[model samples]
Target chain A: MLKMTFARKVIAAAACAAALIAPAQAEEKTYRLKLAETWPTNFGTFSEPAREMAKLAEEMSNGRLQITIDTANKHKSPLGVFDMVRAGQYDLGHSASYYWKGKVPNTLYFTTMPFGMTAVEQYGWFYYGGGMELMQKVYEPLGLISVPGGNTGVQMGGWFRKEINSVEDLQGLKMRIPGFAGEVLAKLGASPTNIPPGELYTSLERGTIDALEWIGPAMDLRMGFHKIAPYYYTGWHEPATELQFLINKRTMDKLPEDLQKILLTAMKVSAYDMTINSHHVSAENWVTMTDEYPNIQVKSFPPEVMGAIKQANDELLEEAAAADPLAKEILTSQADYLKQIRVWTDIADRAYLNSMAE
Target chain B: MLKMTFARKVIAAAACAAALIAPAQAEEKTYRLKLAETWPTNFGTFSEPAREMAKLAEEMSNGRLQITIDTANKHKSPLGVFDMVRAGQYDLGHSASYYWKGKVPNTLYFTTMPFGMTAVEQYGWFYYGGGMELMQKVYEPLGLISVPGGNTGVQMGGWFRKEINSVEDLQGLKMRIPGFAGEVLAKLGASPTNIPPGELYTSLERGTIDALEWIGPAMDLRMGFHKIAPYYYTGWHEPATELQFLINKRTMDKLPEDLQKILLTAMKVSAYDMTINSHHVSAENWVTMTDEYPNIQVKSFPPEVMGAIKQANDELLEEAAAADPLAKEILTSQADYLKQIRVWTDIADRAYLNSMAE
Candidate 1:
């Protein structure tokens, strides 16, 4: 009986040892991921989403996968998020795809087309309508894997210093705008200048430019544009603008499979959170601007201006198709998809809106 | 062995019956839900969100939950969603809480407030900041249960006919607007008209309204507002407008747990999805508006017009607060929250936008 008891004890100890050894061998290797987003350290939507992504990653990884986020312009230039990730200078980046339109013209499909799909449709195109695949195609060329960072839903047209009466008014106006629309603005006789956020106020205030269009009231109001520009505009042009977080393909490929999944999941969560944050932030700013800073004026643009811009946009689109083959492909395919969805949304979406309007 | 097999067969048959019976029982309990909405059927965002809610309820319940969406005007009247829900005439409502400022003044905290929180922040407030609970408190008196149905993110101010050079331009202009901003417009000397989306085109065309403001390019394009109005303005005043789905408290309490969950989940999903869809739809429409519409004009409100509106908003806020205690509470709380988050978003959101502009 004594011998049996001793043997049992030894066997039990060995079993425990085996349990520990097995998990160690089978357990995925651990890693530390440091993400550097272009957002300023203080920007809530931009900074918080990255932080949320990191938090989710940590939770999903159970501390095995640790991701530290540098939200401010810490590691690289704010606009260099894509380039840094592409050049393998950073492990990840979160910024708008339209920002890198020069690098990947087709990428605008993933970010936004001038007045393209809403946030929902963009995600649909990305997830179901070959949008993600097409987006990958664009990102692959730049050695990056693009993930949806966040969506601003339907954006206002933008803020303006002066009222745009007609397309003729846009002509010769020094405006700060970007993306394909910026090019179109240029063609319409407006001098489109691409200025960074930090410079917008000073530039507008200093009279370096006559007009500037930024996100919507949420962002613009917080940035204190109301104090300088005095005119806040709509966001009809961009509509649903998507911000992207580009992860270096090689770096992402090297990550453990579970870690990769965590990265993607966390990003999506952050994206949703950021979008919600943006909505509230803009609202608060608008109220403050109007109520406290009555010196600022908030108003809309005229139909004549919209029409002229629309006409110029057609010329720009044709020119884009003519200039770039990828643009043509995206334009054609997107147009087809839009036509199909439009019919349904028009019937379903339009009818509902009309009912509510009454 | 024979006896065991027979018993097993009986058990299997019973299980199948139980499964079948469950659905049958659910099907027998029919529910007719009346939805009160702020918009008429013509607006996509307003109509689509509600349509989705109804569709989702029907599909999820396998057609047991029958929802009838009453256009804002049909059931009660415009700006009657909360009241109708409270009165038990409507089972559900889709509109902004801000529109019901007269009833539960704090209800505006749930919807988009000027310079308050973005859609994301509003979601956070509702979900995390006890905003939903607070919102429920405000609505409980009216017998309503409100959930976020949709958001337009940021919106355009309005379309203008002439150039606004200063605050003076706001005087004597008949503008179709909505929400609290309308009150501000009244103070600014502009005649504020709350024309639903369906009526905007006609009002502008007939000269009954000199200016009209509706969402951004996507919806505006579809309405052919560009044809009649000629000026497409930005959403400066109403940056991120949130839509709500108000369900009668009595009706909601009567729903089975499963059905209630489905109704809530579906509406939430639809809200996010609708926001995204609207953005995408707008983007596509913008392309058409600019390219196809020849006489259309896309312009911004002049500085002078903006200045006047901003001034009017300040006066309106003060008067509103003095006139109503609810407005004071809401405004104060919103201002506080805005101050807290602005510190972060200003850096992250603003810096990036400024960079993008460059």
Candidate 2:
């Protein structure tokens, strides 16, 4: 019995040493996630966040977290991203939240309202303010999580052949503006149409459409719209068009805590990266446009015109609030936040820009 | 021989099973690092980036990369951060890069400059334009790695007891402004003084100082400057002041790849987070200040005053450029980038803000 006890002690000691000797990597598991992005392959800034996030996640986790991304061209479903992510067909999704508004009405407020808060203000609302919590409240029940993917900072109002000097000019104005802004403009007697991207340039040039609001210079410069439409109006709608990143809750829960942190941190940093990239790209592209086509005239709608558009927007928002409690809650939160935050913006950013403008 | 072989197999199997059964965490080693920050303990936005970065590194690495921070109060070295990190006394540091300009003259360009870019534009420069490479060119040779820590969005010009209507108004005016900005004002005949923060309120109140610029409303509101100084001028200097994170190169190299990535990602995300946080804090604080003291007036230096200050600034920059080749490279990069980017800002953000303003 004494001999057996001594042998047992030796075996236990050997086993403990063996456990310590085993390489840490051998015992750890690698987690693989699949991401589906709304942008087509090589979609420039729009396609960068997910690709960068995936790369960061992989590198940060030392290849422990591997993410594979499929662009819209591969999936043939840019707008179907929300459904795919929610149903667990895709572990992650990169798209806009408002694209899901047809299925989930409250999703509309999460992207950008006609005259909503700008990128930094909206980001402030998301991370520090109550925006993240509110966003979660909408996505949690759907078994998905959504985060701010990227920002297209203050999209241009549109490229117009003729100046919009008054609200009267908007009557029977055929323009290519989509979604909520289009709805708002529709109320102002402008005929808003959603033509596919390929047809936009010719339509505007041939008078099928008088104006079109593509993205800012980053994406729009490639479309050659500045050549045809010389009057470039500044933004009122889609002030800060923040794209959305969607995660399947089950897939997220499956990751180890370290990998989870790596994934989330990557998402956040990449989102911020894309915001800066958008600004950089637009800045570069704008210079190119101005250098080649010096005839481009920058214009803002007159106050009466702006006031009328804003009134129509407010009325639409009121109707949205009346229809749903969740929508009202989000709209109220944004309105209250915008009211408080815009004062500082006026005092800090606006005052600084105006003072320094040439 | 057969009996001996079976006994050996049993022992080997037991060892392998034990190795598999042992906890994964126990075998991993925790790498601890110490960070020293220039800000005193509990300093609001200035101190938050390092604290948040440390927290994130720990959480993301699952207690593997543990960082302990020593604030200015604890270490008694507010300005000695660069020296401490370089000498390996502290593995990490949180401070502004411009703080080290006395030691490394080229370091002044990284934080902010008079009439430079705004927060988003500067962010665009840092991450997208060649700013990061240029920044590293100044830091890498010193055995330290630096990354952006945080940003204070467009600092207010200052709180003045009286308005500056012309260049003559700045003559002999005692103001609490520091760094290159002080030099610019000094060249313009203003007396720029560096007063201790605690004494600033008394100094301004008793006419010991004519005006002072601490920060935006976020920090300024708590100092009770609003009640005393009625004319709050908008910023012309330190637009998008970027704080910096420093790491000892040896310490960074010693870290495992995963831990290295974890630390960097934490630094980046926390930096961006603080930028949003600054905006949020200022917005909230601005509201508080207005509610309590509606007498505070937001003002800007007049065109003649601004023109003089800008001329002084340009002359000083020219001198710095002539003195150092590296300074020339950095200045040229910033000037060229700003020239391109500010045009986009005018068309997008400025136009949007101006159009929407009441």
Candidate 3:
């Protein structure tokens, strides 16, 4: 009887140990996160970073971190990603920072500005310069963590029915441009208007708009704008248009240390990958566009017109800076960084390219 | 007595399950990897990718992955990284692909080629335009897996004691330039010689060589070459000098699926990060160089000189292609890719830069 009693006690002790360790192990439970992206389903490279991030995070965490992405089509709100993520409707969002400019005025600076740094130079500022801190200052107040999502190397100026020979050509020109760039065009006496994406083609085709600025060749080729526009102008505004990833601070804080690192690294790598992919797709599509439509003329606005556009951009920047102290600080930082970096760029890449041309 | 027996049976069953699970858990044992780098300790941006990759891999794997790095100083073989990694003396190596040209002539094409694509374009070629397949064809036969380690965006031609006015100026000019670029210069009647990095500065200072080609401002600033040399020439030799990460196929195959993904993601992200960081450092260092030494003149070789150099490079490439079927295949692919992509580059980035210059 005593032996039986001892066996019973031993079994109980073993049960207790199992109880202790099982839950500890179970603490490695799978975390399911919902991400919302601004781009609709199958929106080319714009939708890539979110999916790539989710896959990487899940793999790196051994299936512990599972992220499901909802495109704008499913969510029925293309521009609502910021609010959705902020209100806890989604844990994360992938969108352009400039998309939130209407809600948060300071958010505009995080994306490319008019005639801003190129992709490499802007990345330098974001990582090495004070761009990240400045970005954090703007986001932390809203309970958000923002990171570089992707970069469109250099956006094209626009597709034009008419070649812009001088500043006078822009006067009273009906163009479809949006956001701050549109505002800059407005300052130059051009009638810059925003149209729905679906309506853009019709507008350009029917002479409703004289010109339209869209994304570069990668995304634009599918839109079929190259079929209508004969003159493709080079970019001046929106030089390095960087998309952004936004995370709810609370959600990020809740993750385990390793999972958190996985998530962060995944986001970072996906962002960089998207940048490279964009360049690749653009090169591929550009070849296709030219091969099929051999008459598509590439043009850059003359120096006189470019100088006028620059002046307008500078004035608007000044006004924005004067209005807000943070804006001033951010603008000043970007300007100082650009001034210092451009010298090197001129000496290195620019000189090299020019030499090759010679 | 019946109740006690039932409880005992349950405990025994639980114990059996735990035993079954524990070995599966034990499979998550930590993996320690040693890596050898071609660069010495504290070798600036060149040493960053390996350390960054190791950190990311460990964090992502929840401490399952740990990597330690040894520089050339410790390994006593800067040029032996390839052999060491191949022999499993080190699990991994960080070096440039071109370093193995003498041993494996086919390894030369993985790094940047003269007059080839720029950084962004080359990355495009690697990921999307079939560069990766070509690289794998070379490395897989040797039981190695190689990935882009990092990039020095564009290397400046060299610092010169006198201006290179024409093709004639290169005649009898002794310069410290190695690899394929040296061969090109030698074809143009320049006496191109290889020297130890430690001895380069003294040689240039003491007139042992009239000029020397090193890395760009990011690395060159530390060497203080601008202090002695007056002319800083633009690059033609290496447009995008991509460093390489070599892994033993057996070592990689031994890793778990999730760990393998973590390792790959870590390497890829670290490589991209280094590219951005190099640009940042170069911009920072260039500022320092010019601020102190105001008289340092930036020049591009005359068109006549560049033309002669191009012809020599083309002939050497032709000979390389004639030597091996794989070499011919790679050269053709690169040429074809460059031809297609350069159009997009011209329309997008190059056009934008020129417009801004105007």
Candidate 4:
């Protein structure tokens, strides 16, 4: 029995030795991905989390895969993130899918679809309810692999230069909005401009733009948006704004199976991190901004404006479904998911929120 | 005069040429850090973001700073995160600060204070209201530096084996809760056990633990906890649970000044990612668990239970503050910040939530 045990121990040591030495024989492939983002390095929204994902991927793969992300303008132009990734100039890109409405009409479904669903509902549809599969279908045609990167739970309407009294106030007003919302704003007789993060400060400061909307207070304060625009409007039109990571298909396909898995897993981690950080930073930013920038008047949108936005959202969603097959599928799926969720949400989630408020 | 003008042009050309050539000589020094985290690699909450930060740090620094994160149980136990980082066993540790209440009473402030602040309020106190300074003061003496890593915004009570009708029901109940709340539970006659994430499943499944309170629906659903308990409760006790990253001061000091800045920037991003992910995931998890787990029943605690929790929280805070001067300072600072925020939250946040609920 002692001799048998000694042989087993010897075999165990041999197995451990093989495990330790196996990795050295394997070839390490380092994939440096330039992720062009519309956020500064210090922006604690999705950009921060994207960075974290890259770090995790490298570690998890035992340094077999390396991804380096250019946070802002370090590589490609910030506003050009989508185009850059689509064209394979960048290995990865982080931005709102809605920002590229002209390129892919169905992209808006991944980011936001007017009053489509809440943050929770969106995640369900995307992950479990075939939302991710459809999203990949759309992105595959664009030469990219997309992942849900981050989300700002529910956003404020946006920062405004003046108080909006009615629907008429939105007419001809220059607003900084991206994605399908811009189309809706344009439909409402407003002019929309796609501005990158850094340029926002200069654009608002020089009166080049009348009104703008970023994530929310936490990020807005950092860029000193409140200093230039005293009237900050709530972002009711966008309750939950999602950010996405677009990886170059060619670059991603080159990675080994394990490395590819690491990147996907890392991206998932970043998605959650972005949400939590945005909430935390926004909360802190609101407090600090109020204390420091006392002149900044934060106000909710007037009932008329909110009513108009809601009405426009419904119309826009219907119009997109009617126009494109992919948009129709994604929107229909998202809507169906939302319909089911609303039943429970209305009864449980909403009820609880109401109960707690009192 | 013509010759002089030519000379000026030549000088300008030379200067422009110098500026163009400077890029070649601007190679940054790359510093690699090995970080240890208590979260599993599959746990997108911390591991994913931590990895992303490292990747972003390298990119933002143009390869000047690189970080590699070791996930939970990869190198050390999750419970050992604080001490491992403190003792310089690892460069950084990403986990909840509340896990180390026995060693540092004030560490809970970095995590969350029961009934004290929402996620936003906590961020406000930490970043702007000298809360970070206080944290540094508390951690520096222990050879560590801390930052807000992530937050679970207003969590669900937990999965209960049976409904909790009154305070009497909680007595002698074996519950799994972390941080100071666990201590409060102990004080209230319940048995509180600090179990790591990996072990939470079997303990709750085998009847070793009567209840377990994790972040919320998002995470709980993923862990499949609802399947066993079937009685989900709202976590009014932990409104906002904060996760923290503890960096070894020695390791941090070794980095170049710019690398240190990059590290801080990445941390802020990681925190944002974690918070947002929690919210988004929680939203979806709620829908899945309710739809799939038919036997699972989601309910809220009675007002009397909530009142008891609030009362217990107040007493715990008072006693803690009385015991530690630093804890008193942080609590006081948080109170001041919350007082200022309450005015707006009560009207804006609560009012909006109330109006939105059906």
Candidate 5:
């Protein structure tokens, strides 16, 4: 394992020096890369990108760029993907960037913000709007290269047992939510609790937790949350929940340019593919959920309730921005971009959708 | 070109057979494929996917696959891409599927419909909802394999010199809108015209055309239509205009497995990349357009006007469906997929965006 770190990566390069050395093609070494995913086995679309990327990398490189992925069931530490990749134990990692927010404060901004841009909007920001640069600034110091892995469009606000009609309804509400969204709920006087996936259905089915926000209809349908919680609220907290792909800087430096390109392209293409798959599955599952359970109601918070939550979110973001320069920079960039792009989105997608609605 | 058609595609297959055949590695061949694009050179994001795909394919295969593209200006055949690729004059082509409607009647359904799905929804329809299979059914008999090239979100409803408040206002309106959209307008007593892009600004300026719909802000801003047309309307006609990559059946069959994988991955990834780039450019360009011309009024057709247009669109579609079984199948598939998916989209993205709006 130690020797293989620098032992592989003999790519079939151009026709110059290698052709001169021998009449026949030169011997090429196959580089095998190991990936660690934060999800367990059969984690649905959340688990698709890593598997698809690895398969594509291998096939494109003709077995030259072999990649094997180990899910969290094998790795045993869902949150330790960053450490394992950075320590060079694994060549790559598939995880959400927000998971590292406790360690790296700026990591929270890379994943979806409370009221940030949607998937495509954030994708534009990442590739064309200086997001990749800012992301590298946050990850480069950790000796890692982080890129977008996948997106879950817009997450459902949560499965609420009771309606949130006003600001006062949020007080002392107990829900199973995580990350900065939980903090926003905390600011609004809700008790945000983190529970394991295996325990969520049981917890929600019983009186242990009043509500829970998993992914969208895709994963949540299987959890049977709709059967227990009748009111499914629309999203506000995390509009575009994007996962991250992390690679060790040392591992990246060891590969030939062609192999490097192959790996990066595989990751990106798979990321987009997974996003489309996520949308497909969510749309399919939403229909299945609604059909199987006709009594389930989809609701949105009243404007006053939303306004209050937005205010709390704004204040929390302001305080975070004030405490750190990087936070302020990321927040400002996102805010300005959202303000500009949302107008076009409103005029383009929103208007079309509204005008066409029956 | 004839020598190179079957001359390349000698992939480094596997170790056992290849190593036994030759003591050293065997020499690989570089496959050069020629592509014809509908757009002329420097046609903005429309020209990006082919170039980016060619670059990625070459890099990933280490120059094993090389693709060269000829623009409409070079070939003097903007609408001849489908013919060129099918006739084996070109191995691949970059153009919209709707451009081939004059040649293949069913080709119109693959690009977009009058009032169809948005970018992501259309993408879902293509990848996950049997759109590719239906597309293949349309193109397979023509000796071509067509895949999505890129998308330009929601196309604006063109720049208008005069406001259209009622259905009566569309009487004899000379609008430079092409494709099935023009047919939809023609049903509404409007004189639909097709002007050369180079002469579009002059035509609108001199009253040769009263209004024109080219694309979104990205391409529109450079055309300077806003300087003359003060009423900028939101889209109703062509939603999610997806470009296409047309590969000759012989061309696809000739490539080695690895090279084929590389080429396909590059095409898919570049398609998604260009979609993101389109969104970025439109957002940036929208800001610039409004900033430079503050008098631009962004409006949507009143409900009555939209209803009339939609009625005309539906009538045309119903006639098309009644005429052909393949057309009915494709249209039914899209309508069903859109019906199911739009509910989730309304609840997820539309709800989220509306809640976030100030």
Candidate 6:
């Protein structure tokens, strides 16, 4: 009986020791997160950032920070990513910040603006300039954290059935353009509408719309717009369309410091990777399109039409600024930054490219 | 004695259980790596990538990965990074790939060529257009792995004390240039020489050299060259000026797969970050320089001079290509990519910038 009592005491001591070590082991516990993306399954470049981010996060954390992503098909809510993430249904979301503009007006400014900075300039603005701080201010109030997801460098203006020679060309012109750009065009007496992606090609083919603006060659080739539209206009509205990664603030705060850093870095790197990937795919697709459709003509808007568009864009921006103090601050910051950076861009990249062409 | 035996058995069983779990704990083992950089400590933007990469790697790996860096000041070998990393004396290095041209002539093609692709185009080539495969072929043979470290955007041609109006002006013009670019200038009947960073100012001031090519406004503002040089020429040589990150093959192979991904992703993100940071700093510094030195003239070489330089560059490239099949392959690949992508660039970014300027 005494021996039995001793054995029980020894077992209790062992149990106490195990309990002491358990907490230390828990410190290395694996954290699993779920991410919902606005894109459907295998949505090409749009879907890349989330998958890459998750893989990197998991690998970097040595499998301790696993992030499983559900595409729109699974979630059955393409535009509901923000709501789901905010409600803690998903720990993170990948979508464009502008998509949430209806719910949060200030969120529109985070994505690319009409005639705004290029990819390089915008990235500079986000990282070194005050763009990131401004962006965080808009997102933090919504109980979320937003980072740049990726960039589509210099989106093509649109596929046009006919050339836009002057302001008259846009009069009552029915085109498919979305977001603030559409509003800008609407002010100029053009009817800008949004159509579901699946219906765009059919709509344009059946004369439901005169023209439509899609992504650049990287994504546009798959949509087969170049086959029907003879004139491809250069970009003006969405020069640098930066997608966004959103995370629930509470979800982020709960991770250990290292894992937090890991997740953030993963998102950042993957975002940049997507930018490069977009550029590559665009270059490749541009080649394919030109090779197959040699008759396709690339055009830029005439100066008169462009001038009118610019005027309308500026007026709309003025109205937005007047509507809110934060909008005014953000617009002023972007305009000032663009003015300063454009000078350097002209002397550096522009001059070199022109000289080389000569 | 019987009770004591039972207690000892219990203790032994507990110890065995702990031993069984120790290996799982060992999976979180910390890996420490040492990196050497080509730049001195606090060398402005050039030094940022290495430090940023190290910090991100550590944070992402949850303290399991630690990378420490030694700049040129500590290692006492600015140009020996390639040799040290190859020899496994340092696990990793941050330097420009072209710096190794003296030891490995083919290393010349990886950095930037005179009138080569811009940063965006170069990145496309690297990631999508078989540039990585070619680069790996060159470095793998050397028992090292080289990845792009960062970019300086478009480097300025140089600070010139005299205007270059024609090709005749380059005859016997003493200039401080380095690497393959110096070779190109030599073909144009110009006397090109290398001057250490510290000696460049005095050399140009005392007329030891008539002009000098350095980085752009981001790095050059502190050098105070704008105060003395009357003409700031646009870039032709080293258009993108991509720096390199080198790793010992053995060291990289020894790492766990997760840490490997972390290290690679960290390097890549930091590199892209530097590009944005360089643009930001340049924009800021350009403002500062112009504000202080209003007379600093930004010049592009006259077409005659630019044409002559291009002819010489082509001749040199031809000679290099003829010397090795691999060099020929790499050059052909880059030329083909540039040809295809430049068309898209011309229609897209170039047209937009020109249109906006008007």
Considering only chain B, report the TM-score of each candidate against the true chain B.
Answer: 0.80, 0.93, 0.94, 0.86, 0.93, 0.94
Model 5 earns a TM-score of: 0.94
Error of 4 at A218 (Å): 9.3
Question: Residue A154 lDDT in model 5?
Answer: 93
- Runs in model 2 with CA error above 4 Å? A1-26, B1-27
How well does candidate 6 reproduce the true complex, by DockQ?
A: 0.39
Which candidate model has the greater DockQ, 1 or 5? 5
Provide the DockQ value for model 4.
Answer: 0.04
Candidate 2 C-alpha error for residue A156, in Å = 0.6
Q: What tens digits encode model 1's per-residue C-alpha lDDT throughout B270-306?
A: 7776666665666566667767766665445555565
lDDT (10s digit) by residue, model 6, range A1-358:
2343344345444454564455223323578899999998988898899998987887676667779899999999999999999999999999999999999999999889988898889999999889999999898989999999999888999999988998888998899999999998998899999999999999988889999999899899999999898999999999989999999999999997777888888889888888888877787899899899999898999888888999999999999999999999999989999998989888888898888877
lDDT of 5 by residue, A1-102 (tens): 213222222333332234444432333456889999999899999999999999888888777777889999998999999999999999999999999988
Regions of model 1 farther than 4 Å from truth: A1-28, A343-358, B1-358
Could you give candidate 4's per-residue lDDT for residues B1-358 as a string of tens digits?
Answer: 2343344334433433443334211112357777888777677554556776777665544455667788865874877888788777788888887778778767767776766676755665676567789889888889888888877777776888988888888899999986678777777788988896779989999999999998677667677787789788755667677888788988888875445755776777567656656665665667787778777777777878767776787888888789878888888888777776554454334433433431
* Candidates, DockQ: 0.05, 0.44, 0.42, 0.04, 0.46, 0.39
Question: Candidate 6 falls in which docking quality class?
Answer: acceptable
- C-alpha lDDT values of all predictions: 0.65, 0.89, 0.88, 0.69, 0.88, 0.88
Docking class of 5: acceptable
Q: Sorted on DockQ, highest at the top, how do the candidates line up?
A: 5, 2, 3, 6, 1, 4
TM-score order, best first, reads 3, 2, 5, 6, 4, 1
**Model 4, A234-314: lDDT tens per residue?**
555566678888889998888655356557767775676566456656666677887888887767666666667767877
List chain A TM-scores, every candidate, in order: 0.85, 0.93, 0.94, 0.82, 0.93, 0.94
List candidate 4 segments past 4 Å from native: A1-113, A116-235, A240-312, A329-356, B1-32, B40-44, B55-77, B186-209, B217-224, B283-288, B342-357
Candidate 3 Cα errors over 4 Å, as ranges = A1-16, A19-27, B1-27
- Angstrom error at residue A202, model 4: 25
Error of 2 at B191 (Å): 1.0
lDDT of 4: 0.69
